[model samples]
Target: MAAEETGLRVQEALDRLTGTGAREAGEDLVRELMAFYGEGLAALVGAVAPEALVPALDRPAAAGLLVLHDLHPEDVGTRIVRALDSLPRTPPVLVGHDPDSGTLTLRRAESGGGCGCGGDDEREVENAIACHAPEVTAIVWEQAPALLQIGSRPPTAAEAR
Candidate 1:
């Protein structure tokens, strides 16, 4: 589905979950469906965001999903969780892969949690980490062996759209 359409669906799901004049879908049901859609959207955005940078940088590998590296292990995990949890009712999914171990870990955003409600305040730290980290990789959405030595740039209008 298109990003706008998917966003609408998420809003509808939120409305239903909150009983805000939406058809009486159960909260649990809405949450489940919203979670699914949000995760998919997150993956799509993750994949596309980096592509917009490739043309500007003249690097093929730069056109992939952004990943945080060189962070303290605990910091990496916390930031991942925090990023996921900051989404609205339809929170995004975070999938992290460790290439050396060939391990992939999946995490869901925590509903109604601390990080989910703070908006820009919470994002400040995340933005900082993304800014200061030079060892990060931009992995292709679903492919592993993350591209090394590539950096993340701010999302462009096309990518944000």
Candidate 2:
């Protein structure tokens, strides 16, 4: 069957299951299929040369698949770093990661001009992380500190030489 046809069939099945229990059962079936495919993916990963897989990490969809199945050889930190490096704008510096809480801490890049709040930049970063490292449940942003200037007294008219 075509991919679209398969998707439609799945949606039709989901639609038919109206009750909570039936819906849960359908979701469970999907999860089972996902696990089955994940195993197949693991086997495929094992068959392929490790170097060949490295290139796939650069592509978002492929990388997400690899990460989803936990078949990507690289560690989470390495993948997170790769995601950050791929950012179009100045990438944030990784402050730390708490695996227990699945929290990632990052220091936002300082902008030469503009508010530097980085609302859009943060979203991009989050999207990249989701693609590469879905295991990160939360992101903590560390805003850049304000610049401080030393106080200086202007020379008064009487003090002028």
Candidate 3:
């Protein structure tokens, strides 16, 4: 089906789920509908946001869901991460770095740790830290003064000069 048709279907399902005295019944219907259309929505998103899909394309299941619905990788990752983060305790950490630009993007990592599951979690963490090296460097630079203030004693006359 076309995107518009899919959207209309989803909207109608949502209306039925939320409309009138049968709120609970509608909610159940909405959940079922969401599960049924989730993959399609993912594919639709992927088609519109190809740049975002790059990161998720490597993962078979995630990529399949995206391809099935034409969703972007980034959107897949974002949604997955958001869902993961909402769970209680030990949220995964996502950290990205641009070395030359000295920029960092830090957020919770995906729930399942992507392909880096098992013992590789350490490596993943290290990689994230490395990616943010420039940001770390800047933070250190900014803290130097405060660190010096904390450690230094009063200067002698000769040192003051």
Candidate 4:
């Protein structure tokens, strides 16, 4: 089944429990299942060679699950880069990521004049990063340096005379 269908089914099951006054029990059951599956995923990751898992990442469902379980072979940075690269529009340059603070700093794409506005673009970036690297809790923008202009120096007083 597709991921969406599976998610809807899970929601329906939860709702059915909620309607029957067993919401807490249903949630607990879900948590237990998640723990069980997480252990399985962890074991699979340990047994398989890292390169063997790379092919699975091509499928969004598999990639998401690996990330959700924190069992993806790639590091957070690699995931972030992959996310950015997947974007249709020009992607920002990654300045740095601070794992301690869960902050990712990025410089806006300097080309195409950058739209000079960020409402839609910012949300898209956030969504992409969150989907790929949920570990990143914050996204920070790094301001590009101001442009410099070159001009002739002023003549000395003696030269002016």
Q: After aligning candidate 4 to the native by TM-score, how far in Å is the CA of 130 from where it should be?
A: 1.0
Order the candidates by lDDT, highest first.
2, 4, 3, 1
lDDT of 4: 0.82
lDDT for every model?
0.44, 0.85, 0.47, 0.82
lDDT of 2 by residue, 41-157 (tens): 788899999998988898998899898888888999999999999999989989999989999999977777877677889999999999999989999988767789888789998
For residues 1-161, could you state the per-residue lDDT of candidate 1 as single tens digits?
Answer: 46576567667667676556455555544655656655664565556654453343222122112232121223345544444443444433446646455343433344554644445643543343344222333322332233368789989999998
lDDT of 2 at 91: 95
Question: What's the CA RMSD for each of the models?
Answer: 22.0, 4.8, 15.6, 6.2
lDDT of 3 by residue, 1-161 (tens): 46576567666767665557467656665665655678566556646755764665445455555534444334433443443343344544444434455443444344543552334544443343333221222211111112233667789999999
Q: Encode model 4's per-residue lDDT on 1-61: one tens digit a residue.
A: 3446556656766667756557775875586567667877888899988999887875667
Candidate 2 Cα lDDT to native: 0.85
For candidate 1, what is the lDDT?
A: 0.44
Better of 1 and 4 by lDDT: 4
Candidate 4: clashing pairs of residues? none
**Residue range with the least summed lDDT across 10 consecutive positions in model 3:** 138-147
Error of 4 at 31 (Å): 0.7
Best candidate according to lDDT: 2
Error of 4 at 100 (Å): 1.2
Candidate with more favorable, higher TM-score: 1 or 3: 3
Q: List the residue pairs that clash in candidate 2.
A: none
